[model samples]
Target: MLNVLSVLIGLFALLFMIPAFLPFLGIANWLLVPVALFGALIGMLSTRNSGRNFCLLVAAFGALRLFLGGGIF
Candidate 1:
């Protein structure tokens, strides 16, 4: 149940991530990281690692975007 919930939250963050990936939109990743991290937190409470890993991957993408774009694109 917690895994499912965590994935759902990750999915919510992913919706934002898609748009944030566009050029000139990298700044939005600042918001995406926290959301993905929150999902990762919930995922960590679950028994399975899939959700947690997925959320972390999502967060990594957000962080990478912020780093590459310098927080504003």
Candidate 2:
């Protein structure tokens, strides 16, 4: 279940990239970072290493987007 959640969250993170190109989307893009982070946290607590790593990667991507775009901080 956690693995599935991680994959879903990763996919969502990928989708979050779309807003980067569409400026009209506004702050909606920033919301995905927390969701990705939540997934990473859940993955970290799970026994599946693959899911954990995948989620961590997603979290990294989300963080990169947020940092580069200056969405937060």
Candidate 3:
């Protein structure tokens, strides 16, 4: 249950992340990072690792975007 919830939340964040890749819209990821983290936290509770890994991957991508954008686009 928790894992499912985590994956769902991560997907939600990913949806929002689409625009965040825009040259000047990277700031949106500031909001997405926490959401991804929350999903990761929830995923950590599940016995399986798929959900946790997915969320973590999302978070990492967001972080990389932020880095490339210099923390604020």
Give residue 52's error in model 1 in angstroms: 0.5
lDDT of 3 by residue, 1-73 (tens): 9999999999999999988999999999999999999999999999988888998999999999999999998
**Which parts of model 3 have CA positions greater than 4 angstroms off?**
none
User: TM-score for every candidate vs. truth?
Assistant: 0.93, 0.68, 0.96
Q: Which window of 10 residues has the lowest lDDT sum in candidate 1?
A: 64-73
- Which candidate has the top score in TM-score? 3
Which numbered prediction scores highest in lDDT against the true structure? Answer: 3
lDDT (Cα, 0-100) at 39 in candidate 3: 96
Candidate 2: pairs in clash: none
Per-residue error (Å), model 3, residue 43: 0.3
Candidate number with the higher lDDT (2 or 3): 3
lDDT of 1 by residue, 1-73 (tens): 9999889888888888999988998888888899989989999999998888889999998898888888897
Better of 1 and 3 by TM-score: 3
lDDT of model 2, residue 24: 47
**How well does candidate 2 score on lDDT at residue 19?**
61
Provide the lDDT at 56 for model 3. 92
